[model samples]
Target: MSGSRIDFRKAKFLISAPDIAHLDEHLPGDVGVEIAFAGRSNAGKSSALNQLTEQKGLARTSKTPGRTQLINVFELDEHRRLVDLPGYGFAKVPLTLKKKWQQALGQYLQERSCLSGVVVLMDIRHPLKDLDMQMIEWAVESDIPVLALLTKADKLAQSARMKMVNEVRKHLADFGDAVKVEPFSSLKGIGKSKVLGILDEWCKPQWLMDTLEQAEEE
Candidate 1:
């Protein structure tokens, strides 16, 4: 399929509920690249994923802060898995719950060798919080590639959105090697192409790359 014609289809939920400790078990053992998404509560992580895949209600999107208590995993073409980590930095949530989710998310991020990259979502209106910075630091320390999505871009004016993206990029300059920041809007479809392009990089199965290339020349 041509890249521009890309639309989410034939996508089904493989696993709806996944706990922190059992995330590895829920994942297929065949060993392929899996991209994970992380963000603070109500950061539009789920909404963005649902929009990307064009699957409404695919991942749970909640209005209440700290609603996602577990890591949710969604399958893409049965070859790639999009992992959704629980949110953080919602001080209104209980301390015990926060710590538990944090440890689970931290373990997954730090130990998952199959994790190809992490898509960290931040609200365009309020892009970088202290907790968001910490997550970037963790990805950097682990040498994991991160793509920052300044979600809810439609909520901001066009000029303001550009300014916010630049500001966020500057803010993340210290971790340049580990992350790339871009503005995204699930509502306006802004940055959809960019998100899909980044995902394409992860979709290329290295094991099949040579074989596909040879076939293409035929």
Candidate 2:
């Protein structure tokens, strides 16, 4: 898999599960690799997904925050997937609904064995809220690699954007190599290749590469 790169444009919707139980029912046993995208309600997660896959409407973008309430899965291939976890820290939602979403999110992150990595998107202007830090910390504690994507970079000048990126990197430096930070803009296509390259690397764990190789041999 050395020279191979995933064709993100090939991604298609797989399923949307409201909770881990349903996710297990549909994608039983959690047998393959899954990289998840998570963020606060207004962090531009959907825009980033659509931009990354070169699809205009892959992940639904909304003017209102907290519109994504389910766990959406998109398949890249038989053995690879991208998961859109529900947006967190939205204030307007009912308490019971919010608690339910939070519980579902917690269950998926803690129980999913095949989750390969987490892309934690944040608005460039407001990079690390308490909930955002909690997400990153949870992933790190689980030994999962994290990409702290500073989205909406187009809202800032280049120098300011890079400064924010560096600041985030500094704040998360304690996590060492487990965490990586990059500034991104879906509108400007900034950092798209870099982000894709990281995702491509994650998609090819040694076991998955071996499985792909064996499949080809068969």
Candidate 3:
């Protein structure tokens, strides 16, 4: 592989798993690269994914928060996958169900060996909630790169948006190169290219690059 750009528009729904056990059973062994998308309920996670893949209904947008109750996987290629994790916090679901969902989310984050990157979407108007911070910290601690996407950037004025972006950058500056923050709007298509570029970088792991190089040599 030449570390080529991935055509995210080609993303297709692969499978949905309710828990890590099912995920392991379905995918088995955690062999390839997986970039996960995580955010709170109604944080525009589905919208961001739809925009990224250019599929209007790929991730199933819903007016109801927490409709994405399962671990939805989308395949870009055999060696690469995009995971749509269930939304956390602010979902009006039952207490027991909420706890189960949270458990699954935590398990996936802590145990998934193939998770190469995480895109944590947050509302620009209300960025960096406690859950969001925890997600970022977990990814950073796990040595997985994160794209802290401030979603719905169009809701704010240009000045405000830029200011919030800077403030978030400063707040997360301690993480250094492990995290990258950006303003994104699914409606306006803002920052889509930049986000995709970052994802393209994540898709080309050193192991995959080495394999591609060896294949070329053969």
Candidate 4:
């Protein structure tokens, strides 16, 4: 995260996993940190991920919802990762498959030791649904930090966008202090900076801790 900017043009395909056992093969132990992008099927999660990484076709944008069915992993470097989690709440898949996804996702969020945080995306027009709240609350319950992005802010007027952002922030306050909500638009590149800033912070190198310690001693 410190050596160079997070250019998704440089993001190589790591792997896609249907379960945690496969994910563990690539990112074992606490050697690296992952920030996951998760949301409902039509929330524009893939688009937001591509915009942040600066790659157009990196995550595949499609009109047909529920195109992504696995945990897609992309690496910024050896130390940092951006994970595109399967969208929830409306995939045309079978009930058994849907249940499988939910169980796997729950395990990944709660048990993945190196998972640093989660970036939850929701459409600005429909900010906080029960499913969205459940997702955010799940991460909070796991003691994982969450950044909720109100995607597609470009569709709304500035006043409406700000109002939604405020309302989201206030409602998430019920979850915990770790929850943060912001307005984002991938098409217009709105809030990309904030997303990147959080990634860089989470993926900050281990050496920075030494510098802080020395400064404190001085």
Order the candidates by lDDT, highest first: 2, 3, 4, 1
Q: Which scores better on lDDT, 2 or 3?
A: 2
Displacement of the residue 30 alpha carbon in candidate 2, Å: 0.4
Per-residue error (Å), model 2, residue 192? 0.3
Q: For model 2, what is the alpha-carbon lDDT of residue 73?
A: 96
Each model's lDDT comes to 0.78, 0.93, 0.92, 0.81
Cα lDDT for residue 136, model 4? 86
What's model 1's lDDT at 214? 69
Output the lDDT of residue 192, model 1. Answer: 88
Q: 2 or 3, which is superior by TM-score?
A: 2
lDDT string, candidate 1, 1-218, tens digits: 22233245444567644354565566667366678889988788888988898887888777786776787777765456788888887668778877887888888787777787889899989877888888878887888788989999999889999998998888889886678888898888899888888877766645646555666789
Considering every candidate listed, which one attains the maximal TM-score? Answer: 2
**Of candidates 4 and 3, the better by lDDT:** 3
Backbone clash total, candidate 3? 1
In angstroms, how far off is 205's CA in candidate 4? Answer: 6.9
State model 1's lDDT: 0.78
Against the true structure, what is every candidate's RMSD? Answer: 3.1, 1.0, 1.2, 3.7
Candidate with the larger lDDT of 1 and 4: 4
Q: Candidate 3: lDDT of 168?
A: 99
